[model samples]
Target: MRAFVAIVPPEPAHADLDAFVAPRRALDSPWRWTPAHLWHVTLAFMAEVPESGIDEMVEEVAVVADSCDPIPLRLKGAGMFPHAGDARVMWTDVRPTDPRGLGDLERLALRTRSACSRIGVPTAGGDYRPHLTLARSRRAVDATSWLDAMEAYSGPAWLAQEVTVFVSRANRSGRPHYEAEARLPLGRR
Candidate 1:
């Protein structure tokens, strides 16, 4: 099964992002708006895990969750991938601007990757860049007005206290549907 580990956004943050992106979606460009409930920050993509590996993943997540504290995330800025013209994924950027600044979450991902490797699961290909995926555009949106609107949007700080392992399955629409296979909650340290 296709799987990935991610930080589920808090409710307020999700709602805020939905409102922030609403105007941008009105632009005369092709873009698929992500469902509000599905917004999250991906930490690692564990591809094609065997059915037998599910238990191991749960165990690893428990260990990591127990060892770490929750991360306070701040949402800031909007950005496009592959430059402004030939864009593919549009997202809202997030960073740990607090004193600890996502340090705990970073360490947990490293640990999760090492643990997953033992079970023959491959992790994400590149360095972790935390962002909330807003849309997958069918065509490049080069509208200056839309870009300006996105640039002016901002959201408040939110808490990330749980790491969820999601099973991504393609639905009848061919769009991916994510189900939380398991979640590990991080209480205050």
Candidate 2:
């Protein structure tokens, strides 16, 4: 199974972002925009794991979830991956609305990654910058204008209380669809 661990924003956050992006869709850029419903902050990307590993993966994630409390996060600002000049992906930055939430989020991410590692799940090792991907480009495109437009966007704050393991399935149109296989509640709430 192709799966990943992520934090799904609440409905209010999604609505706020969707409303903001609706007008910008007229830009007609060659970017393939991601559907708002599929937006998530990915913690660890486990490309392909055997179905037999699902049970162990869920248990590991639950342990990490139970160790942390809900995190308050907001979708704010915009940026591009690999720099703006040669950008491959466009995303909206996600950060804790509360001052202390930043450290909590960082720790949660680390704990989640550790849990995945303990279960022998291959993880994408590197710095984890929390962001919800907005779009992707097949080739490098200048995103200065798009970035500028999104600069003033600040969505509603929502509490992230669960870590979800999502199974990714490829569609006929080449776009990927994600289905939540397991949702482990933080602090067991």
Candidate 3:
């Protein structure tokens, strides 16, 4: 199965994001707005995972989770991927609420990626800049207006206490659908 590790924000946080995005959707924008259910902060994206490795992955990820403290984060600001002028993806920032939480979330991401690679599951290589993807455009275009509108947006804060390994499958519409395979609680292992 296609698998990835991610932080799925809790229900309350989802509600807050819904409230923030409702007004923006009403404007009939050009981008295909992502539904709230699809929101997540990916830690590692492994293209495929054979069944033999699931046990190793869970155990390894659990160890990483044990050492990292729970990170409190909020969704704020906006930016475009591959540059704003020819933007294909737009996302809302995932930021630590205070100085103490800084680097912790990124550490969690890096450790998890390393854990996966140690098990021979080659993960995507990139700098892990935390963000919840908001929407996608079919073609590259100037998304300056959308970026400007999202600049003032900030949602309610929430404690991210768990890391989940998700099985990603393609739906009929060619969009990715996620199902949590394991919920690895952070800390207190």
Indicate which candidate wins on TM-score.
Answer: 2
Off by over 4 Å in 2: 169-176
The true-structure Cα RMSD of candidate 2 reads 2.0
Model 1 residue runs over 4 Å out of place are 141-145, 169-176, 187-189
State TM-scores per candidate.
0.87, 0.93, 0.92
> What TM-score does candidate 2 reach?
0.93
lDDT of 1 by residue, 13-63 (tens): 878888877666676567787877888888788878887888888787777
lDDT of all predictions, in order shown?
0.77, 0.87, 0.87
Instruction: Please give the ranking of all candidate structures by TM-score, highest first, separated by commas.
Output: 2, 3, 1
After superposition on all C-alphas, the RMSD of every candidate to the true structure, in Å, is 2.5, 2.0, 2.1
lDDT of 2 by residue, 8-44 (tens): 9989899999999988876778788998888999988
* Candidate 3, 57-174: lDDT as tens digits: 8888989998888999988889998768899998989988988675999899999999989989888868888888988989998988888988788888889999998887678998
